[model samples]
Target: MDVSAETLIKLYVTMQRIRLFEERVADLVSKGEITTPCHLYTGQEAVATGICASLRNDDYVFSTHRSHGHYIAKGGDLRKLMAEIYCKSTGCSKGRGGSMHITSAEKGLPGSSAIVAGTIPIAVGAALRLSAVGGDGVSVAFFGDGAVCEGAFYEALNFASLKKLPVIFVCENNLFSTHMPVEDSLANPIIYKIAEAFKLPSCRIDGNDVLKVYKTGQAAIERARKRKGPSFIECMTYRWRGHVGPNYDVDKGIRTQKELDRWMAKDPIKALEKMLIAKRFLTNGEASKIVTGIEREIDGAVAFAKKSPYPPSDEMEIIRYLFR
Candidate 1:
């Protein structure tokens, strides 16, 4: 797996940015500054960073509720994203859509939905439209393991396979959907097998390893661009934070502390750093400098969001009328 030094550095920087951003968001949520229900993408940073690195600026990405990492990795503006979470007028959605509904058409992120599996069909539709126009850009749908149980998941996969649409289905299998473990929820528990059943090219990779994810995503994207049809990529990863909050969910007794510690030990950011240092791609001092820069960027975004004002009361009514 030969990757350029520049690409590897970019991947590391992107992952760091996501980690800092999510950590800041979690702090804000704890302080009640960010009132929105934010699903922090703390430990699953590598999946988004690796996958989005393979995408062009024009390639579309449909995201799930845990969308901040996807948005940031896909080149979304940090200030606008933070402002959106703060429900300010300068937000990406003009404060209309909060954390779960961030969208940036300019960045090729059409939108994300709060409802599980809601964006699957939307991504398939977008792929169909792209196919009709003979566009070379591929569309990607980022969903979780829980969505596989939904009818929309099967339906979207079936249609994409049937039409050979240029779309990539990325399932971030974090082992749990909300509080329910995969064992309790899924009868089979293996998601990639379902994609195999659809006769689509599919593979499961270690989502924590950015290199593995990047290589696999590159292949999937290439297949889609070649019009070889949709591909399913199951990324086996874990989320460090609770299902919906900033705290660990061990208190709820759904997951054991031992289980959480085991996953935490495989922290993607540290793993990448270790690999980079080992390969002479980056020095410890250089990595520290990179992290410091990202922290400053995150701080600036937080300050920007804080200074931005909320939308006027009348503006909400006008938006409602327009949408209606």
Candidate 2:
């Protein structure tokens, strides 16, 4: 894959926006401003930014409980997302759907669900719909490693392969299902093998490396767009926080400090920054300016969400049947 100065800058900006947005959300949740169970995608920003960079506006993308990074990567509005997290009336889901359920239909993020692998079949069905229409639309499913153990992931893969649906099943293998490591949960723990069994092409890459993720994603997305078939990518990454909170004990037995330090060395944002500097895309000063600008934008979004009123009591009553 060729990297130009402009493309590198765009990636840097998108990753920065996602990182800052999640950091701010963590603060908001910590302060008790947001009541919903919040999941921050701080350590997994690279997967979303890299993969979504290779997609088009019309291509569908599905995400899991830890979905903020995917939503932001697919051109979702930060103000509306923050509003949704805060449960304000102006939110993307009109404040009814909290953080985990955020969606942007216009950007092809139909919605996310709490159930693991819930969106796999949904993406497959959407891919089938696109196939019927003979459209160029492709669907991407972002799920955790735990979701791969679910019946839905395998069933959807089989169905999509039988019909050659234009879908990309991406497993964001953070090595844990909530508090438990994936090893304790499954025998054949490798996600790519599951896709291979379904007769689909699969690629396993270092999810922390943004360039590798982007290149692999580009190839898979291109294959799907051409109506060849579905593809799978197992992204080996980690989440810095607990399964459902902002912060936790670093010395906790669930995750070790040594692993954290190793992953920190491969920070996607910093890696891209070094690349940009080496390529002369921008100097230290320019990079600082860009970071400052994104911080300001995120602050503005937070202010917008905070000032926005919560849903009226009667309005909440009207939206109870949204799924129906």
Candidate 3:
């Protein structure tokens, strides 16, 4: 795919937003403003941005715990995302979901959950609806490498294939399931190949390279839109922070500093910026302006979250949501 200058810039901007947003959330969580556990999506921004670039506003998106990147890339409101993490009423999930359970109906992001492989089945259900009702829009499920171990993943793939539903299963393989290395957890460490057993077209791509991810994602999404059933894209990426919390997981020797550094060197944002600058698609001045703009947006989101009131704590008021 010949990616244009505008697309490249857009991808860069989206990745920057995800990176900055996650970084800001980490800072807030560190200061105790956010009381809940947050699984930061620090390093894997490319997978979401690249894939989401192919989706329409009406296309469905289901996300896992490390969901901030996906939500932002899918066009969910930044203020709502920040406020939700702050447990404020203005949040997309009405402050009920916090960081891990964010949702945005208007953006086609129904919800994200902390449970392993929880949203995969729901994404399949959405795709089934799209197939039955007749539409080209596909449902996408964004999950970690750990999700492949879940039975729901296998079942979802089977059903999606059996009925020829339009769903793209995107596995962000960051090489670790929480603290444990992916190699130790799965019988077969190769993730994308697993979809082959279910007769779905799948492949592994470099998650750090946004352009590659976008091209491959476009193919998978087009396949689903063509009613060719599900396609699995295992993007090999890495997360910079701990399994849960603001701190890096290296303190307990969960992963060596050297290993972390190696992945950090391949930072998606940095890589894209370098490519854009080298290609003369982006100048140094524009790069600085882009960063400045993104930082200002992040500042605005933080202020909104800080001022937003927390959801009503009264028993009756809380129960009202259950009825709705």
Top of the candidates by lDDT? 1
Error of 1 at 101 (Å): 0.5
Indicate whether candidate 2 or candidate 3 has the larger TM-score. 3
Instruction: Name the regions of candidate 3 deviating beyond 4 angstroms.
Output: none
Extract clashing residue pairs from model 1. none
**Model 2 worst lDDT run, 10 consecutive residues:** 315-324
Q: lDDT at 80 for candidate 1?
A: 98
Query: How do the candidates rank by TM-score, highest first?
Result: 3, 1, 2
lDDT of 1 by residue, 1-324 (tens): 699989999999999999999999999999999999999999999999999999988999999999999999999999999999999989998898999999998999999999899999899999999898886899999999999889999999999999999999999999999999998888888899989999989888999999999999999999999998999999999999999979999999989999999999999999989888999999999999998998998889999999998887886766784877
Better of 1 and 2 by TM-score: 1
Residue 144 lDDT, candidate 3, scale 0-100: 92
Instruction: Compose the digit string of candidate 3's lDDT tens values, residues 187-297.
Output: 998987789889888899999999999999999999999998789899999999999988888989899999999999999999999999999999999999988998899
Give residue 28's error in model 1 in angstroms: 0.9
Model 1 scores a TM of: 0.98
TM-score computed on alpha carbons, candidate 2: 0.96
Top model number, TM-score: 3
The 0-to-1 C-alpha lDDT of every candidate, in the order given, reads: 0.94, 0.88, 0.91
lDDT computed for candidate 1: 0.94
